[model samples]
Target: MGLIDSHAHLTFPELHGQLEAILERSDEAGVNQIITIGVNLSDARTAIDLAERYPQTIRAAVGFHPHEADSVTPADLHAMAELWNDPTIVALGEMGLDYHYDFGDRSKQRSIFARQLAEAAGRPQPLVIHCREALDDVIPLLLEHGFEGRRVVFHCFTGSPQEAAKIAQHGWRISFTGIVTFPKSTELQAIAREYPSDQLMIETDAPYLSPVPVRNRRPNEPAHVHHIARFLADLRGLPYDDLVEETAKNTRDFFGL
Candidate 1:
């Protein structure tokens, strides 16, 4: 079975400029499916366009990232809501709190996050979360908005074991990126080794976090997702093919891919 890069930013300038080569390389690396994420309104449109251009292999997830929360006007939220009408849009968000950088005002971030969560309340689409040093706020906010279980996934997770456990307890999923393969990520690696297989998923988070061997490389692409899958398999002590099939199945099931 082909592998899937559950989360990526194919519309980002670093990867968007070489789309053809990227897809070719991804195919060669057994990464046949990808969900390109949008962190803003403009890229969200581009993401849907890319998905439409490559309907058989790519899909889109749209939202306003925490950093962009500072400038989000009511019109922007309205426009984002309208994007869900597109058949290619599979999920809502890369949205959430980001206390680490504080790129957006904390108050605004929470407000936008809550608003998006409210929008997502009864929608069939799942949510792709972008949380960093703010799980305390993130988890509660998600709950307040009535989201739980398999409907949410913390993408590029780099939280403490306790945080991960909390997410698991809520029945939400967690996705790992190249960061887990780093030599210094002992805690994350340990968590990955024991995380529930059914809820575990892998991604390249392309245009960022290139895994181990290629850790030094810039502009990570979807093709590098295979490295993440292989590393996770080895860390979890499962056969590589088995890991690929399992994660691919989980991604398809979670995103309704």
Candidate 2:
């Protein structure tokens, strides 16, 4: 089976303009499917458009990012809530806390997160969470709302093993980005090596954290997921093809693709 990029931002300008070539390279590299994430209303619509245009290979997730939470108006939330019913939208996020940047007020971020979590609960859809240095806050909010039944995933996970275990305890999955391949990511690699295989998945988070061997080479793309999968295979001491099939299956099962 080919690799599935569980998370990416193909609608972003870095990769959007040359989608044809990007997708071609992705397909050639054995990356079959990609979920393009939308951090706000505009990108959400754009993501849907991209999915529709590339129906064979792309799916979409829509929600306001925590960084953009402060500017989110009631109308924007309403619009996103309405989008929950759109058949093409597969998940509800790219949302959560971001205390690392403190881009938005912590309180505002929490409020926005809770609001979106309620919408996700209402629709009973999976969530693509983005937590950075705020798991302590994010975890409680998710639990307080009783997300036990939700299929939530921590995207671009770069957390301690304890944090990973915490997420897994809640029956949530964690997706690793190219960052896990960095030489300095020994701790992350150890986590990946020991994390339950069924709860593990890989992504490129393209147009962002490019994997090593091509670090800072240029804007990342879905095609680079191969590097991540290979790195994980070596880390976990599994056959390369086996890792590919396993992660692809995890991606499909999680997103219900």
Candidate 3:
């Protein structure tokens, strides 16, 4: 079975300028599908456009990332909500808390996240969360908004086992990126090793974290997701093909692909 880079930002400048080459490489690497995520309203529109252009291989997820929280407006949210009408818009986020950079006001990030959650309250689309050093607040906010038992995923998870367990307890998912392959990410590898297979998925989060052997390469692309799959297969003691099938299935199930 082919692998799926469940999370990526294909519309980002780093990758957008050379999408044809990227898709060619991804094909050669066995990454048959990619879900391009949007960090803001404009980016989300671009993501939808990319998905529309490459219907078979790309899908889009829309939301205001925590880093852009400070710049969001009520009208922006309304326009984003209108995007759901697009058949290509598969999910509603990359949204959540990020205390690490504090690029956006923490209060605004939380408020915007809450507002988006409220907007998504009963929608059928699953959530694609972008939590960084803010799981405590993230989990509570998700629950506060009645997300328990809902379809949600914490993308590029770098949390501790306890945090992973807490997310699992809520029937949510945790997706891994190339970061898990870093030598210093031993604890993260451990979390991946034991995380529920059904709730597990993989991504490149591309134009960003490139897996080892290619980690030195800047502006990582979906093609590098193959390296991540191989690394995780070894880390979890499973055959490479098996890990690919499992993660691909999980990604498809989660994103309704």
Candidate 4:
């Protein structure tokens, strides 16, 4: 039952502390590949370095997350644009607006997101978006400039079934993280029901949002993505092996893995 964690923050401090052990456990859990998402300029170098050093174990996606909107500048965006040339960097994200945190100026978040999206336009690279209580603004941004060679996936999706359907209609995929396994996440489970099997994917969002069985831990890792796949497989009444294969293929095709 080979699998892939489409979104895992291996560069995060908590998980990065024990990356080798985590990788060993991920392999044991059958999670064959992991994508390390760079949420800000600070982590970009680490993400790229990891991907370059361990091409078979990791891939990268770099962008300015909404939380860091205030910290980023036009100069930061320019630097990120140059990173597009790195073969190990597959996506421009996890980037998008997030009203939930309100950690940065909302306007700043929107501006950064739009800039990043525009930079990603026409490129073959897929996007790893992180929309949070801001899909009303997020969806249209993605629609404004259509994706090209690769696809876009809403990582650790926390949207409603309606929002999921809306993105699905636009040819984007929605990924579930350990959060989907939360006992209280009935809505996430319901949203899961709305997407067609082929349009859904799973992730760990490691070092955060660890699924139910593993939620007690502060940080998560790729190995725990298996818990999400299992939970969804049972929730959807699909065979585990079939679900794993489909999601793995979905990850590869979306990221051009």
Pairs clashing within candidate 3 = none
Q: Looking at model 3, how many pairs of residues clash?
A: 0
lDDT of 1 by residue, 9-92 (tens): 999988757999999999999988999999999999999999999999999999999999999998999899999778999999
lDDT score of model 2? 0.90
Better of 2 and 3 by TM-score: 3
lDDT of 3 by residue, 1-257 (tens): 79999889999888757999999999999989999998898899999999999999999999999999999999998998898778998889989999999999999999999999999987899999999899989988999999999999999999889998898899898889999999999999999888777767999999999889899998999999999989988988999999999999988888889
Ranked candidates (lDDT, high to low): 1, 3, 2, 4
lDDT of 4 by residue, 142-169 (tens): 8776652238888888877888878777
Q: What 10-residue stretch in candidate 1 is worst by lDDT?
A: 142-151
Model 4 residue 148 lDDT score? 27
Off by over 4 Å in 1: none
lDDT of each: 0.92, 0.90, 0.91, 0.84
Model 4 is weakest, by summed lDDT over 10 consecutive residues, at 141-150
Model 4: how far residue 71 lies from native, Å: 1.4
Score candidate 4 by TM-score against the native.
Answer: 0.95
Cα lDDT of model 2 by residue, 1-257, tens digit: 89999889998888757999999999999999999998899999999988988888999999999999999998999999887787778889999999999999999999999988877776767899999999999999899878974799999999998998899889888899999999999999898888788877898888999998889767999999999999999998999999999999988888889
Model 2 weakest lDDT span, ten residues long: 116-125
TM-score of 2: 0.98
